[model samples]
Target: MPSLFSWLRRLYSLDTLDTRFTSSASASAQTAADTRPPAAKDARANSIAQGARAPLWRTPEFFVYYLFFITMVPLMFKTVVDASNENNPVYAKYSHLLSPGWVPGRLMDNSDAQYASFHDNIPYLVALLVAHPLLRRVYNLFSNRSAQSSTSSAAAAFDAQLEQRMQFDFGFGLVFLTAIHGLSALKILFIFNINYRIAKNLPRSYVPIATWVFNICTLFANELCHGYPLEPIAMALSPGSGTPGDQGTLLVQWARTLDGFGGLMPRWEVLFKVTLLRLISFNMDYYWSLDYPSASPIKKKQLDPAALSERDRVKIPAEPAAFNMRNYVAYLLYSPLYLAGPIVTFNDYVSQQRYTPLSITRTRTILYGIRFFLTLLCMELILHYIYAVAISKSSPDWSIFTPGQLSMLAFFNLHIIWLKLLIPWRFFRLWALVDGIDPPENMVRCMSNNYSAFAFWRGWHRSFNRWIVRYIYVPLGGGGGGHRPANGKPTGSPPPSSGLGAKLQKICNFLLVFTFVALWHDIDLRLLMWGWLVTLFVLPEVLATMAFPAKRWSSRPTAYRVLCGVGSVGNILMMMVANLVGFALGLDGLNDLLASLTGSYLGLAYLISCCVVLFVGVQVMFEIREGELRAGINLKC
Candidate 1:
């Protein structure tokens, strides 16, 4: 109907609309195509990350081994129980009459009481076992969620962060395994009197030889689960062969050649020997396995060039990677302090490639020497006295003392031992607090804090505590940098950096730290009760700290000086009471006495005495505080 020019214009407008639609659709399609590669690549990276993070035993091998061991545990327990019963005819004859209705004869008499104890402890064991797998799944889910919400860089950073934790977890697994094994053995020896000599002469000829072979095989299977070699040669060449004196030494050296190599040959050989030596040393020293090295997921990796320019870059020193065998040997031989120690980090140890005195000074070398002498003196004199007067005397049917007297003595002895230990700790703290020490900065900071007054308490006893923290806390989701709301606050409570937040944070920190402090002593009902009571008493001081921050007081001369003195006295009393309570609970007779004493007028008197002591404690704190204040004022004037 239109002229030719108008027709051409109409055609152009329609074409423009069509072109716009086509271009928009093409753009959308192209965007989707471009995004697909990253999504796929991200997924691939995640899979790789997960693969790297996965525990060593992914297949059913660990399960199969666990089941096999579980079955054998019962059998081994039975053997020991029977053996114990046979040895103790007195118990064997009368135990039936004394048996409570709840305990079956088989359950009471079973050689595998320790192993079966785990069976009875099914709830706890199951909880621990299930917790790890469940936590892993939960972690994975959270990781995925975080990745989805975050940029690729953030996601990558998270993965790397998790990787460091994984390394700690892996290392701690070795410690945990060692603890379980050592503790089990110790329990058997202490409770059932299972003689180690029995193992040495376990077989009585051909049949015994077969039994030994079977036991050896079982041991091999157990070691295999832990990624250790079960080769007989490895055992023979291990340091401090269970045999006594020079005969054992010669045998160890001779067995070294069985590997058809020298003592320091094959890397696996060294690892195996070291593992053996560590185990042997743990047994010899009656110390826990806090130093064992295990396979780690956080292998050394090249840093990305892009991340180098970041402001928060942690510049770790460039140190040699080789182990200082000389220092390692020295640490083993002379330093009983490391029997429970600084829990030397691999990084710290490797940094000192030479035996230089400066390196030693940096490592608080002077303190090490002081600790050695002090520890030896305490072990010889103080511990010996406690052992003779308390532990030995407190045993059943003591000729020199009544059970009550012995119990009281035992309680006081524990206090003495704690005091003795404190002396060395004070020295260690002084060394740590002094400037320019090469010890970890965190260790120094922890030493400086008044709350951590107990030497064997968490940060101060770095070796054992670090092992426990790594093995237990991190895996349990408590230790990692994952934010825990400030103390006394609810789990999901808003952080307390704001005005209201500070109070909540303080409360949470107090409760959490105290609870941890209590649990760290041991896993027993008595320990828990003791911990709870101590926390109640200690909470006020912690709250005070929160309410009046140390820094704030430091600025106010009069207040600061007074607070310092009070703090010192308060901390000492709190520690002493905590130690005494812990000691009383540990004593078999003392626990009974306390339980019996709880319902009388005398009990009321005892309670009053405790309260009065606590009051005097306050006075002591005031005096100390006032003294510090006077000193500060004089200095200022």
Candidate 2:
């Protein structure tokens, strides 16, 4: 097999992969350029010879893990939001399940259960995934025995053949999922207490069985239930919603009309949802793979037997997927991210699992642990503490705060939203990192120091953005880095940025992407509006930066430093204000915002004045720094 570098070169371009890994490189350079991180040089060398190892506890994660394991954490932390919990009828019934114990559950009534229906199932999934080491030991006993058998080589070859044959066919995928998940589905359906809660707190001995089944009937397999999933099915069964190609009514007609494409609108729910895109990506990337199964092969009955081509008789196959069922299942069902995901591509995941076994090091562990801790601090201190205080004071009364104050509220609120994502998302990403998968981090560095619209969206829920680019943007002829102009650009497409057509194409692509984001988030008008607001912001920001670009401050470090500090604050202001328009408005808040827009326009002027004051204040403060020149000296100079 080729080295990882060679494989990446084949998947993407030589430009995307480091030039050091080029085929023309000398043998020694090639060897050295094949760097796999989170692994020691020696450990990497022995990875093929040995097996995968376990992750260890480190800084921040260690603290959480230790507390969860040792302390009476269940009893220590309880947030009683409603008085109903004190007198709740279900509380007495499920009290034992929620008792302070290992993997404790929560007692929730009908009033508060909606929020947790999905979130709560994750802990059960996590427990099973955490028990993966135990499962591996059992599998190893058999694998070790197979290694000693004379027929092992032949068996491996057969398995390789099987992997190659199981291409992108929905029938095969459906059958695979059905076979794997059938038993667990029965358990979930038939057995009492074997529901989500019982699944989480299931007896340790029975966990491996249930978990294996869960992992096996995989989400990655069935290809998003063909005509999309749940929502579409409902729409199709509804009285007036026409079939996909046929728009039944005004709502359906308008939906199909939105993107100038019929499918994206009428079955808008299918296109507008978030999780569905991940499934769409899995299908697209799987089929896009080299030597994969072609679209549902023409049936034998549909073909004239005499004229049946060679392609009909023997199906073409993609390169062998190289996925053992065990590892494939593990990637699909890895618990920490099973609920809150930065979904890893199967190819990246399998490569990490098979070729790059992560060596746990003190430095790596501590670094990951510290990040986890920082995320915790941001979540607790900024979101829980600050947001709670802010939310309590916020109301519909327009006179409560000036425009400047509302803008400030928007800034803090956007940060709170990003921080909220960090809680579960960071935990999921950190778990995968410790295991050595390098599953793309969700929030990336956006929350830390993002300054531009491009940087902000790219950093937030980053994996999904990648999925969109790979499966949607590039496929739709949007060209940029890693994408060639000819990939899908039409014959009459604009030649360059100097042309009007080129600018229009850029705008079109921008709007389409954000529109998709709107749909993905929800079919809500506010979200679509939000998407457009962001699109407008990013496009101009990109153009403005490109047009009258800032001076390259490499020669003047102080000036550049000041520019950066100012830019950070500006970014927050723009980000928050846009979010306020698109998302952060309620009934009273909406009235207040409208009042600012319509009445007197004084609030708007106040907002502009406050921003000016803020910028000038920063400039003055920087100029007057004790180590540098003071403001008084600057007036003379």
Candidate 3:
């Protein structure tokens, strides 16, 4: 029993062995190999990388343990399927489809409003993807290149053509936005111009503050205005109300006409949330570029060459001319990433235009496509057989389920949520890959594989994680220390050294980041609570790792490994609870779940069994990671 307890703590400590995500693209740029580190990197390639060989099947103990886990998979499915069938007997007739001839399948619930929108728009996305390359080709053939110097060398001229190609692509994106959004595109353009002006016209010292205020306000204003209907404003400004004769008439007509044009994509704010992030990226990158000592006027050398590593290229500031209204507009409205992004920084996006990353090869992209389709098929299977989403939506009596069944219901629902997001992000990213742009890969690990909270967040929506780190966390002093401005005062007021103060600062930074994340997702109180809950959940693990720094006890291998295992069990439990509250079940549902588990003998037995199962599962997770390390791959998630 003591050994088992120690093993649990060891699981947690083992997780802390991985390095934190790198600070910024600039920090990466100083290194040659990384402009932006690939979401996953070769373990052999990075100095911090660690590798070990620990094959599960080689050890009898693990082989039995893993076999049990494998066997439980089908049982877990049946548990949820039984509960779903019991809850919705009407849908039980569709059970025949599961066995054979599963065609033209039915969704027990199509109530997921967000995914419904994406599903409806698949044809449109497909059309856009199909047309993108053709559009680029047309632009290359017909777009004037007379502006380039005819006497330039082959490399220089080729570089200029690529530069011009990006210009065409960016402009084309604006047109794409307009087609889908109609007059609402003007609203996006208006916000873009406002943000661009702030970045350009404000003093370098003042840009970050002004940009944050304006963009954050825009986000709130957008929600408050409900995408800012023009007709209502026009009605308020009508001549009969107060404004003189024809003065408001023409304005009213324009506003009404603009309102009419919004019919194509009335809910423009959905995409604008993502667009808002790009706005911030542009201004912030522009702000930092000004501080770059090497920044100079537009020059031919500013066009990044094919030879530059992605890390250096991403950090290298584009010339002053590149920040113009046209390019700024183009970058913000870029089609593939505009709706939902594996966000690329402004500098990174511009750099890719100069030369595609070496990683975006034909074989790799095709492989990615195959992976995406397989995952999509997996989602389809889950949707058809599990009906977790439908079951969750229906809100059946929770008390009826055995604790294990209830747990699986929540677990499978989270899986559905993960798959829904993963499929769409992969789809868009694959589209970008086809177009020779490599946005960061978003979901890097299975939801079940994660044991650490930090690792979970790092791997989940990974590009967004990087975005927050660079633009938000680094600026706030979560990096090595706070970034110093020209005034030489640290912005984040980071602790002078590591101790209680540093940990408090780190917690505060996390709170701020998660708060922004919640707000960015939506202006909902539930999400805000979720964010706070996640931070709270992360606290114990953070404190635990600090209290028992792995190195301090590394010499006592038996005791240390056991200690980490214990911590890992607790961390995994907390992570699952937090995620359930945030994504699968709400706070009330979680409360009910806990109450039920502790209320009765059966529930208590089930809960204990789950913990036992989780302990073994976490060990397997550790070994899987170890296997990856042996293979010279480390995702650092």
Best by TM-score: 3
Each model's TM-score, in the order given?
A: 0.35, 0.52, 0.85
- After superposition, candidate 2 runs with Cα above 4 Å error: 1-129, 141-275, 291-318, 321-334, 357-363, 382-384, 387-395, 401-408, 434-436, 446-448, 480-501, 550-571, 586-637
**Model 2 TM:** 0.52
* Candidate 1: segments with Cα more than 4 A from true spot: 1-338, 354-375, 383-411, 416-495, 498-538, 544-637
Q: Could you give candidate 2's per-residue lDDT for residues 118-209 as a string of tens digits?
A: 23554753564455434444544555565544435753544433332222122232333333343232221232122232233565345434
Tens-place lDDT digits, model 3, residues 1-637: 9997854443222111111122223222223233233223432334333334346557787888868788887888989877666355534533332332143543333345666577668788888788897778777766555554463586676567657766876788877887878888888878888898899888777898999999999999999898998877987877464355544566777887878887457888877888888899899877767655553422334533554554455556776667877778778877888888888888888777776665565655665676777786787667666766655555556676688878888888888888888888988898888887778778867888888888899899888998898789977888776655334566665554857877888898999999999998889877888899889988988889889997799678557756777788888888777777777667877888788777899988997888778777777787777665554445666
lDDT value for candidate 2? Answer: 0.43
lDDT, ranked from best to worst: 3, 2, 1
Please state the error at residue 142 of candidate 1 in Å.
55
Query: Candidate 3 regions off by >4 Å?
Result: 1-57, 86-108, 144-151, 238-258, 294-304, 484-494
Task: Find the 10 residues in a row with the least total lDDT in model 3.
Answer: 12-21
| Displacement of the residue 480 alpha carbon in candidate 2, Å | 4.6
Worst 10 residues of 2 by lDDT: 628-637
